[model samples]
Target: MAERKLNGGLKAALEYGPILAFFIGYLQLKDQVISIAGTDYSGFLVVTALFIPLMVLTTGLLWALTGSLSRMQLATVVLVVVFGGLSVWLQDERFFKMKPTMIYLLFAGVLGFGLMRGQSYLRSVMGETLPMRDEGWMILTKRIALFFLALAITNEVIWRSLSTDAWVNFKTFGLTAAMFAFFLSQGRLLQTYGIEKDKV
Candidate 1:
């Protein structure tokens, strides 16, 4: 399939739209309970159920429309199926909640492994759109890897130590805000390295 290069806006929408749907799905079904579970069926399960199909459909739509999918997008769609399915099947929220941690760790691990092997994986994945020198790519990769690791750790803390509702709030709002801040913090670095003009 020919790769249809996505603009930053569409990429952001594709990445975050399903996430926002999760929150909306949760709220829409917050008070409803599934009786089959006999006890633990809750809003979390509803959202998880809604999430699986919604995400799968969204990913399929993206692929059908764009004729391309990124590595990260493909991985995330699979994770959503595995974890989200498990969450609904088991009538437990933990599986769903852990999805973000796993994703963050996976990215961190891949990037860290690349750095260990003396490769800037981010540059390989994003070089055309996010042009940078070797040094800039190295530095950006390190910071992004660390940031991803931090996000994983934070997800662990929030999900493990808080109520399901609180965790959802943190996942939808806190994480989103933090991600925006992280990108903002990299503005000078992006400027220094010079993102591709067409991309910017």
Candidate 2:
């Protein structure tokens, strides 16, 4: 049988599903651990230890079910295993927190380098689905790279300064809302560059 094509909604769900699952699982498990182990148990610490590997497993299952794993997904899995193992072995949450930072910095550096070379990596990723003029793609790439950088900084601040509950809330709802807003704001550009079915 031929593989089914995933629409934007499906793609978004698959991409965010594991993260959402982790958030939910962490909250539930944290409560359970605290309740079972008494007040002495560090719920946050316990959840942090369990979250990464759970997320990685969830993501892998999602990929297998969908039969799709993009380069970004592959990179994410690799990071999860490496950093997650370090987190468990070292008994520290710092490595897990740094994962997003590393991803953002890597993307920023690569995109910045691509821009310098007159290439738009973002365009390469989304070009087929959202065809646009060269200038439009370049603009989109720059904007996206900057957005990722902002998200990275935000994650760092939240993880460092906020309570675990707050960080979890931000990761689940705040970050998702921000991304949704960003996507909606790009509607005008997408419309401008959108190809009609007749044209396609």
Candidate 3:
């Protein structure tokens, strides 16, 4: 696939369309029962089975459109297939439920590893978009890494202590909101550390 610049709308669709489909699939199928190989499965499992393939499809589409996938996107798709496949194969949803926790923890660990080496992987990924001094990058990376750990813990607690429906809602909306708020709260740091681009 050749590298191509994607318009914002197309990019967003490729990134988020599968998640929206999964949510809608679960909502519409939750009351229905599915049978596979003479065993009954809940709508959650069925939706997850569908979601795994949808995720793969969207990921492929993204690669086709952009000629590459980010590490984050690759990790997410792989985890979804692994955990979601287990949920469908074993007729249990717990594995799928743990996917978010696993992803967040993995991300946190990766960032922590970078921090241990006195490097900012976050800056490597976002530096072009958010230019800042090395000190600023290190500070932001530490904060984001800690935030990912907190999100991992939060996912574990919510899934274990709450209803499946509640967990789904939290996974879909609560996490998104929390991330948005976290970044929004970093406005001060962004402003303080941002390097002004030279005007043409």
Candidate 4:
């Protein structure tokens, strides 16, 4: 089927619905031990397992709607499968906890490498959505790259030093909020360099 572009609200839901599911699932299952067959599993572990399929489903739906998945979205699903699979199989939450760190670091590395090459990879990814001057692209890319790097470092410290519940809370809410705030803070730059309304 040819994919049809979805409205912003629907697109956002597909992108974020899985993560929201994980948070709600964890809260409902926290502190409980459930038996499957003869093996007992913690609520957090079960939620982690469920989260993998949910993410996959949402990603699939996104592709169905848009007829394409960004490289970043594909990478995210792959990481979730690898880390979440290991977490479930090993009954260790640490593996799942490190997933965000890996994702953030990978993004930072990609952006940083582009910067080193005097390129704006972000422009390649988002140029269609937000047409702008090359200078604006470079500036935004630099800021986002640094933001991703900082998030990666923060993820490492939070997951390593904090309790599982605390880490989950940070992952579920804090990271999303941070990203939103970061992008919202960039409105002036976007407007300053964005293609004029008539030009677009």
Best by TM-score: 4
Error of 3 at 91 (Å): 1.2
| Deviating ranges (above 4 Å) for candidate 3 | 1-3
- The order of the candidates by lDDT, greatest first, is 4, 3, 1, 2
Prediction 3 global C-alpha lDDT: 0.89
Per-residue lDDT of model 1, residues 1-200, tens digit only: 88786677876676778889888888778888767636657877877887788888878878977898878889988998999899887877789899999999999999999999999999878887777778889999999999999999999998998887789889889998998899899989878877566654
Better of 1 and 4 by lDDT: 4
Against the hidden true structure, what lDDT does model 1 obtain? 0.86
**RMSD each, Å:** 2.7, 3.6, 1.7, 1.4
lDDT of each residue in 1-200, candidate 3, tens digit only: 56678889988887778877878888998988988888898999998998898889989988988898878889999999999999988888999999999999999999999999999999878887788878889999999989999999999999999998898888877988999999999999988888976621
- lDDT score for residue 8 of model 1: 75
Error of 2 at 71 (Å): 1.9
Q: Report the lDDT tens digits of candidate 2 across residue range 1-200.
A: 33347676766676787677778777776565444333343455566556666667667666766776666677777787777667656757677767777777777778888999999988777777787877878887888888888988998999899877787788789888988898889988877766765565
- For model 2, which pairs clash? none
Model 4 segments more than 4 A misplaced: 1-3
Per-structure clash totals for the candidates: 0, 0, 0, 0
TM-score of each: 0.89, 0.80, 0.94, 0.95
Output the better candidate (1/2) by TM-score: 1
Q: How does residue 107 of candidate 1 score in lDDT?
A: 97
**Candidate-wise lDDT, in order:** 0.86, 0.73, 0.89, 0.93
